[model samples]
Target chain A: MIVAEQKPLNEIKTMIADAERVLLVGCGTCVTVCFAGGTKEVDLLATSLRMSTKLDGNGKVVDEFTVQRQCEWEYNEPLKEKLDDYDLVVSLGCGVGVQTLNEQFPQKQFVPGLNTAFMGLPTEQGVWEERCAACGNCILDKTGGICPIARCAKQLLNGPCGGSQNGVCEIESDVPCAWQLIWERANDLGQIDRLMELQPAKDWRTSRDGGPRKIVREDLRLVAHEEE
Target chain B: MTTSTNGYKVGSNLERMIRSGEFVVTGELGPPQGHHAEEIREKAALLKGYVDAVNITDNQTAIVRMSSIAAGAIVVQEGLEPIIQMTCRDRNRLAIQSDLLGAAALGCQNLLCLSGDHQSFGNHPGAKNVHDIDSMQLVQMVKNLRDENIFECGDVIKEGGPRFLVGAAVNPFGDPFEWRPYRLAKKVAAGADFVQTQLIYDIPRFKEFMKRVVDMGLHEKVAILAGVGPLKSVGMAKYMRDKVPGMIVEDRYIDGMTDAITGIEPLPPLTKRRKALKAQLQELGEDDPARAEIEAELAELAPRIKEIQAERNKNWREKGIQMCIEQIQELREVEGVAGVHIMAIEWEAAVKPITEGAGLLPRPNVGSNGSG
Candidate 1:
């Protein structure tokens, strides 16, 4: 899931400071699961903004709304009815949600209230750790399901680079070394020899190095276009 | 020993010495932070005859310094063979290959491919690192460029490719300690002609690693040069032991460094005594007998303390060099060890004394014995 966290209160306040009326838009999708832009958070942010603005002598009308999924245009169609009522829309959803609101309602100004962190899940009760780099090509099978691209500080394929000491990365004492985990996992599976084989340089063409990516499912297209 | 039809691969002096079955020695020369070419020349002058080759580090520890190839060119001009260290942290494949070609054109005959120290450890922590290829793939890439006459992208080189005696680093002391030897074998399979290990202070652990490597018959596949460096002080020994990742500085070395400073007052005590005496003299009458006595003691103690400090500093360095020499001698006895890579970073002059003290002076000239 795409994990995101809300921007600082002061920074969010600055974003909507110029507008007389502000709507705090929350998403019910990934951000909601992560407790970032859920309906509850939107209500809290709206109340904080109302109180803070009142205290600063420039109290403005602050309202709150939640969409089922702000990333989809249809799910965000309900926001259309409430769009003109507010001068500014601050999205507490992931980056994708902010862009969707902008494209759906071009005339209304939209600003991000959350920073999209990474594609990950809550490892513990409240902590989240990144698990995927979305590098397009995956080599998790070779590395015993651990992703060095996302976990290792250097993204080293032929690792763990000399920095792995006592099962932790040199970057920090708490961060477990990815390659060390891979090695131990491989050892447990009796596939240690697999790591001995030289893993060649990764072809990064499928990754972001190839530029912004898009997937077109020709079979799933309802309206087929003529061939060029 | 492997040799090409015309000469050894790349015909480098380091390769020649290694191939000719002579115990070789390579020294390290760290480029200055500023563009001081003469600094490189002066350091190279210290290592010229004592070592088979000198390794010019590529912004080692992620600190910005003169480029390795540029410093290596200076070493070449100073009548020394240079093994230009190239790290993957700073360059992508395009820049790496381009720099190799440039390095070769500049008369750099050897290459040491490294996964550079993380940029976060350096001055420019904000700079983005470009580890487009790791060291293993880099070794293979260099081999492909030299042997197959092809670029990493499979484009044929119309003319000459960079012919280098390629090398890589290993950390026998690295974690998952059992896997370190196999890592070296991987490098060998990746086409590394020579290997220099991380600094070895724990000799027993290194011997265990080498035993495994020898058991695998990896010694026959690649020339392994043991990395050794002098510990400047007890603080340096402790830093290497506690702070440096993958480096295992035994407690004995720490004890040795500490012992070097034994019986030498740390100057603060002498200075404190002088301060008290001066205060006492100031409070007393101008012509007092005690004032003259205190003045005489102060005059003698100041110069004596300076000499003591100088003596202490010299003892620390001597102990450092002595320890390095002892390690070199011991490493020479290891079955799989090919040579010693003396990395006297910043203290280049120590290379001479370390080499000379180890009885590795009068380095073998393998120039004419390329086995054509």
Candidate 2:
């Protein structure tokens, strides 16, 4: 689950203030899951902009629409006809959706309405807690289910630091000590011995530290090019 | 020959009844879990004569619920005043304006503007949130309906233009309590006539909040309604304390419940413990200094425990009937408070007893004539 919060209304209004014909686009993907951009949100933002502009005497008009998924080309093609009618596209989707819309409609400018936060889950109703960092690596098998990259203050790969007080992270009151949680889970599984095994340092080649990365599955590649 | 009541011109007969200090019961009916209308109708009938109005919630928290406009129409058909809650979560300006018009045509006279909960909080985790406009903008939209009667579509309605009794929600207990008054002032400036607050638990803190409201001179511009919800059980109380932000559960309320469980009188145990601890500590103070320090610590614990116990007792006693009275009295005493919005959630039936016990008159039987 991608968790995100919408920017303040004044900021969003200012972003598209100059656009006479605005298209409020909501994504039905991660951003939608995070509630930053979705069909309902798109409608709401468009209505608010229209009302605000009318009150300001500019009489700016806004049209609202939501695509099934804004991150993919196939999902964005349907918006082609409507994209030309707008001076600017206010994307209520996530970072991916905003970029996808920008790529698809290069002629029309795209503005983001949501500040994409992190991959998380709804711990309960009306509460979304971040749980993963998408560090391009999976280490849950060794450290238990808790992800230190997201939960730990230091993102420590080793054991808890001196700052882990009473099984809680010192950085924040509600934040649980990730290393402590890992230790407890390991102890519960009768794997306390695993903690003694000093693992070597992690490689950063495949992660963000190594710059942009891509994966090409040879099995799924299409060989036929435009027969030239 | 109808005369003005309480300095308010009785433009409609209903306005006269509202001004007469009637019960003025208002209940919030959450949109159904799905598209079905049977359950919505059933709940609407329960409050038909009992409440002055029933508010239909929009996609609360960005989760898909039954449409507020549709639910509002249902309540109106059931011969009850329907207050439509519109949030800037799922719709932009155009849709919001259109929905407001639809609501007006369906006879929804009350409007509650809100910047809804984020989408991540809803059941559907993969939903987008639209906060293109905030609550202030929505308030302005309501003001437009009352003034120009023009929607975002640039079209003018020929008949039955909306005349909404606009309201907005506030969270006085939310973080940075200092900023709340300013935020509320902004809402008022945006054209809010009434303000409903989040559930209030600490009466003393709420009094302080009322003082701030008075100090700001907001008493004359807008009516304020204190929001209250009964603590059904100990588990519920704990949930509110541990999870819900902006809710402060007084320490005494928790201890009162603990005493009740042991079948011992709370006041006796609390007072006896405190007196005994204090006496032991005083005796120790004359003897060994270190022992006295330990005893002093113990004495401090006793007072804290007693304080918790007292609060618990107060909450237990006042939760059902006494709390309502206190809230009502608090509302009456406050310079700006005009009413109280009781959000009993599933305890809708208990609202009647609580409000009536508080000496509040029931809202006028507007539905008695069979027209909503």
Candidate 3:
């Protein structure tokens, strides 16, 4: 889950104050999960904007619409017909969705109404905590199912450092030491001996270190030109 | 004009005076589920001549609460003033306006506007939500009724309509506390005449909130009724702390409750009983190392014994009435507090004594401003 929070209402209003016709578009995927840019939120934003504009004597008309997934061309294609009716598009989607909307409608202006925070999940009601870094490599099997990359303050792979006091991280008292939790889980499973093993430094090339990466399969690819 | 007020009328000069901060007492009454006109009438009879007004909640939290309009009508028929709580969660502007008109025709003069709870939080998980408008829009719609005497679509029904004394809900202790005063001001600007906040446990924070309210000039514009709900038991205190969002239960209060009781211990047996026994045996066996070693074996047995004890106490019974009375007394003494919204959820029968102990009973006919 990608967590994002909506920008303040005043800031959103100022962004499209000069536009005559405003299109409020929301994505129903990552942003929706975070309670930032979703179908319900888009409707609310549209109504609030209309009310604010009316109160300010701007008298601008705002239209609201949401796509199933704004990060894909298939979802963006549905909005093509409605693009000409509005002067500006206010996207309530995540960063990827906003970029995709801008890319698809090159002739129209696109503005983001949410700040994409991190990949997280709803830990409980109304609370979203970051859980993954999408580092392209997962080491859950060795670390007792906890993602040290996201949970650890320094993302230490070997063991907890001296800064860990009484199983709590010194960096922030509220944040538990991930390595300490790993040790406790390991001890519970009677595999405490694994802590003595010296692991080698991790390779970073598969991650963002090698620049934007892509994967392709020969069986899934189509012949150039002939496929069209 | 009929001497007997049947349908809605403008709040009587007397009711308006009470709402204008004159010396008056206000209490809230939540109607029971199903047809219990007698039950409602009984509660109203208890509050008559004691409370200046009673607020009827509108399907609080999307639950199947009795209709506020019907409850308001019952309160009116009993000759008690009714404050109708209207929420936007279950109705659009058309329905809301019509309901407002119907409530007025029923002689309900006081209006409390709220943006009803999300349907997901209610018991009926599969119910559809109708948030056609937010609280602010609803407030504006009410103001529209006051100004143009027309609905949102510009259809005039009541040309010289009876006035509605509007109120709104504010939760200062909820998460994002900084937003409370601002939201209150927005509601005021949208035409809320008074504000009733969510239940407050921490009085110091409530004072700080009062200061903010003063700074924002909201205190001058709207009468704020402090909300107070007496803690019923230790288990309830813990539940509110962990389960309820935006509620902060003070440690001192919890500690006080734990210490007040005698013959009953507060600690879990595993940590308390075993540790005490181990310490006592250590003192006695300090001279002989082997004797001390023997005591260590018993230390291991302590945990098993403690577990059995814990299982036995799991079904132990306790009473909560005395604790609730103490909490009520403590809340009433908080400084800068104007009044309380006694929420005795399911314990409404105890409200009269709680209010009486707090010296909140015997409300005056007129408000502090002497304008009703």
> Over the stretch B1-372, how does candidate 3's per-residue lDDT look in tens digits?
122233323445334543445533466778877778987898887766656777788887567878999998999889888888887768866688888878877877788877665455567868765545556666667766765576666677555443577777877775335445655776777777667777666667777777788887777677677766555556666786665545666775565445444454444655565676667776674586566565676677676766654543332212233444455465445433445566666555556666566566665544222112
Index of the highest-TM-score prediction: 1
Each candidate: chain B TM-score = 0.90, 0.75, 0.75
Cα displacement (angstroms), candidate 1, residue A27, comes to: 1.2
User: Whole-model Cα lDDT per candidate?
Assistant: 0.90, 0.70, 0.70
Q: How would you encode candidate 2's per-residue C-alpha lDDT over A12-51 as one tens digit per residue? A: 8899877889888888877777667888788887788888
DockQ of each two-chain model: 0.64, 0.02, 0.02
Q: What TM-score does model 2 achieve against the real structure?
A: 0.52
lDDT at position B143, candidate 2: 71
In terms of lDDT, which candidate is strongest?
1
Give the runs in model 3 whose Cα sits over 4 Å from its true position.
Answer: A1-228, B1-24, B259-261, B264-337, B367-372
Minimum summed lDDT over a 10-residue window in model 2 chain B is located at B1-10
- The TM-score each candidate achieves on chain A is 0.97, 0.93, 0.89
Query: How do the residues A36-113 of candidate 1 rate in per-residue lDDT, one tens digit apiece?
Result: 999999999999999999999999899999999998999998888898899999999899999989988999989999
Q: A40-130, model 3: which lDDT tens digit per residue?
A: 9999999999999999999678999999999998988889999999999999999889899988889998999898999989989898888
Better of 2 and 3 by TM-score: 2
Off by over 4 Å in 2: A1-228, B1-23, B152-160, B256-322, B364-372
